[model samples]
Target: MRFIIDVLLTGLAVFLAALVLPDSAVSVAGFGWAIVAGLIISFVNATIGTILRFFTFPLNLLTLGLISFIITVLMVQLTSYFMGSKFDVANFWWAAVFALVVALIQMLLDSLFKSKNRD
Candidate 1:
């Protein structure tokens, strides 16, 4: 299904982020763990993130939508916490940076998938 593909792409994006960021910023011990963290991240973003974003809509508007990045960073931190040793982020700032990269990758992948679906 499309959801499964999305999760796998998210995992690839996480692996890419781990490779791009400095070792201290983010690290995934293995591909399987990356996939697990990715699935959790996707689920959290779809569920908890939706509620948080809805409640913070005013703040997000005030910040010209930049608050969404903060929300995403928190989601990534949550994923790291839930994943335990499998996924690690040194701190909030590092997690923020990693989240930005992951978001960019996810956006690109989403667009690609959408285009493929349309075709």
Candidate 2:
């Protein structure tokens, strides 16, 4: 299903971010941790993230929606917490960069998958 694919894509994005960012790392357990982090992120994004975004709408508008990127950073940090020792982020700034990379990867993967399905 699309949901399952989205989770997998999210996991892949996280895994890739870990590889590219020195400020973040994944456990030796690897894929399992990545998948778990991805699931947590997706769940939090759907629930808490939505509410937070709604409440932050004014800030989001004032910043021309740049605040959404900060929200994404918070979401990633939340995911990192649930990951326990399985994943780590150096700090808030690092988390922001890491989340941005993951978001970019997810967007790219989604577009690719959608195109493949279309064809």
Candidate 3:
């Protein structure tokens, strides 16, 4: 159940990223690849993202939350590279916007599901 939910969330994130990033494109091969890529991305974010965040904590603090945007952009680019996809983000700013949109969509979906599950 949890695994399925995770995959769905990942698909949603990918879809959101694709929608926001003009250069980001997902092939119709199947959602399976998307789910797999999403899992890999999640793992990378959980591990590497933690370390990067820790190291950049000071800079993040100084920037007053702006650094997180940069972090998300990096993660997206890394994910694209890992998947060997042609998801060309225009720049960091576009990546940041994509990340923000993806986050918002994921959050909304998670919240909706969680609320229903609690009922």
The top-ranked prediction according to TM-score is 1
Model 3, range 1-119, lDDT digits (tens) per residue?
A: 77788688877676666655554333212456556657766787788887999899999999997776677678876776766643445455665676777778888888777744553
Off by over 4 Å in 2: 23-28, 115-119
lDDT of 1: 0.87
Q: After superposition, how far is residue 50 of candidate 3 from its true place, in Å?
A: 0.8
- Candidate order by decreasing TM-score: 1, 2, 3
- Which residues of candidate 3, in runs, are more than 4 Å off? 20-30, 86-90, 115-119
What is the alpha-carbon lDDT for the whole of candidate 3?
A: 0.68
TM-score of 1: 0.87
Candidate 3 residue 19 C-alpha distance from true site, Å: 4.0
Cα lDDT computed for each candidate against the true fold = 0.87, 0.79, 0.68
Name the lDDT of candidate 2: 0.79
Task: Give candidates' CA RMSD values in order.
Answer: 2.0, 2.4, 3.1
Residue range with the least summed lDDT across 10 consecutive positions in model 1:
110-119
Pairs that collide in candidate 2 are none
What lDDT tens digits, residue by residue, belong to model 2 across residues 28-61? 1487678788888878888988999999999999
